[model samples]
Target: MPARLFAVVFGVLLTPSFLLGQVGGDRLIARISRDDANGDGKLTEAEFTGPRRLFETLDGDGDGVLVIEEAAARLAKVRSNVAKAIENRSEEMGNQSQREAIRRRLQETRGGARARVEPDHENIRYGDHERHVFDVYLAETEADEPAPCMIWIHGGGFRRGDKSEGGLFARSFTENGIHYVTLNYRLSQHAIAPACFEDCARALQTIRYNADKWNIDKTRIAIGGGSAGAGLSQWIAFTPDRADPLADDPVLRESTRVSGIILLNAQTSYDYRWIQEHVPGEAWKGDGLQQLFGYDVDRLDEISDAKFELIEECSPLNHLTADDPPMMLFYRRSSDPEIAEKNAMDGIHHPIFGTELKKKADQLGVGCEVFSVENENDMRVYNQRWTMAVDFLKRQFESVQ
Candidate 1:
């Protein structure tokens, strides 16, 4: 199993006390608790699916049984050791240290899988900006036909993320006969709203302009990402084709329209007013909102009309029409309004975002599927969401063919 998967299972099962205090903790605990085969409110070696060594560690007191309380205490000690190691290191650490550590672990665990298919091209410039670069993983298909392509955008609430994050999906798509491209774009901190959107648009156009060189079927391209990246994908998919025939730049003349889009934990609309009305609680107060729109969130009531219009223009929901491509949305959060109301972060990624978008798609006779984790059964199915998304993309490309 991948180390990230191990982290998820162990994080949920062994650190119950730590997780239970956070958002969706109870649901995560309940999901992992299903592994307790003999159901005496504890997990034994036979019941655990993780590494035996890990199981042994969690089984405190040499009891051969692992309960939540004991596991939590053991995990606390493990955290203390990690903290000490960080302190002993000569390098300085800050807020980003934890994120960097997780990223390093992910890269280490995925090293073998990543080595199977290296990028055919890395850091290909799409625009003049330093961040306007993408990596391409060509499909390993035996056939001579150009492969369908999917461009992935990394999610960091429009503030922080890297193209390296695409490593998670690159192998999966390329092995299945789909060309995968992951790109970096300007974050909200670099420039607001349209700058990030424009960077992505330019990246798509650049890909299409060089389609023949990469053996990519430009007509069958799709876009996807998580969170802020998902919103960017939606923005590109729903908007009118951004092809500029009269533009001076040759790349800009290429069409930006895609066959389909896949969104994971997406915020379909970033309009503060729409979010406040549609999603319960303080969903509008999410990070990067003010930076994205270039407006003061606290002074929204006194904002100029032009700023309000900018918000509408930036929101993917406002761009949706009959011409938009089909979309498959997977949200990790529950659809329950009460759950959304309880946490700001939960509200930001709540399933209501997908439901609202689906409603609009249905009215326009467009294909849209929304999936959310509402219970243990839903959690089980959630593990298959990636496969379902790939199937959805395949169908989309087939339809166009």
Candidate 2:
């Protein structure tokens, strides 16, 4: 489990009173209540299948994996489906308030969509069990040269998300001349932090190992993700030095650095200053965060130091040296006015807190661009973000050529 995630879950379980006033508290509680098994009102393996199915759907490549692009594509589909459902349900109910609520839910559902994707399925080993898998959206593009590749990681706070959710974005990337791969990683209560990261790492290794066959530029691979997955993607770029030397598998031994990165509304740090002031409780327990770090707050200092080591090794911001690859970021408007106002009040310009990071990149002479999606509609935001990202990748790919 990741330490940051551990903090989140710890906050959830230990502070029931505090969570009553949380922004999305009721919805989260309902999800947890319905999904938990054993009448324990907590998540168990049995209760986690809903999220896992979603994850499997996102890993469209049938390579027994999930990547960022595929994950985004899958979520986009869910969003689209939810939106369509709401619209239909709204018309049936014929109530302005009810219809508006459903419409808003649908709008939030497809918060990330722009491309189209078709996934292939397969099975992979999970311990002694064989589980389903998925791969990227490839619609038979016959290129003379290997296509530039991207592997997307989905964000659901490492609990509930899928690569296929990146449907629209994945299709857009592939159409723009980049081969996209999406996959599912082990999630909380099913597996923990390193489990998901290891899954993502393995998927990339599989692609690189089979690059010749897949016609991909093994050297030009890029990684991107939204929210929590974005943090994981950043981990891959930041922790290049921690590449295992004695690992038996070639992919495990390989470095995780990519030629570039695309981040959207990522939670960049876990210093606990802001969350402590605002959330100040333990109602977030049994959430995906605890599963990632493998520890609670009591052991956090030791874990924090250890994770800081990992952070130094894995944070892209730390590796913002001249040799680092070009990076692009997108920030969408926060749904909550208070959160949005806090951002403005604090001078925290970008939703992902990339303003300072961009400045650092400029000083280092590394190329970095930042874009903000002004719209609240998921489709429009997805369209704008993908356009900007595709343009950036075109330039990067052309520069290398």
The candidate that achieves the highest TM-score relative to the unseen native structure: 1
lDDT per prediction?
Answer: 0.76, 0.55
* Model 1: per-residue Cα lDDT over 1-401, one tens digit each: 34553454334333333442333334434544678665555664556665554554454322234565546554555445444434443343345554455444433332323322457899999878899999999898766789999999987678776786676567778878899999999988888888999899889999999999999999999999988889999999888889989999999899999999988889899998899999889878865798887777777678889888888998999999998899998876678998668666667878999999999999999999998977878866765766777788999999999
Tens digits of per-residue lDDT, candidate 2, 9-36, equal 3232222334323334344344545553
User: Clashing residue pairs in candidate 1, if any?
Assistant: none
Highest-lDDT candidate: 1
Model 2 misplaced stretches (Cα beyond 4 Å): 1-116, 120-134, 241-248, 253-255, 273-288, 295-316, 334-352, 373-382
Every model's TM-score:
0.73, 0.60
Model 1, position 208, has a per-residue lDDT of 98
Off by over 4 Å in 1: 1-118
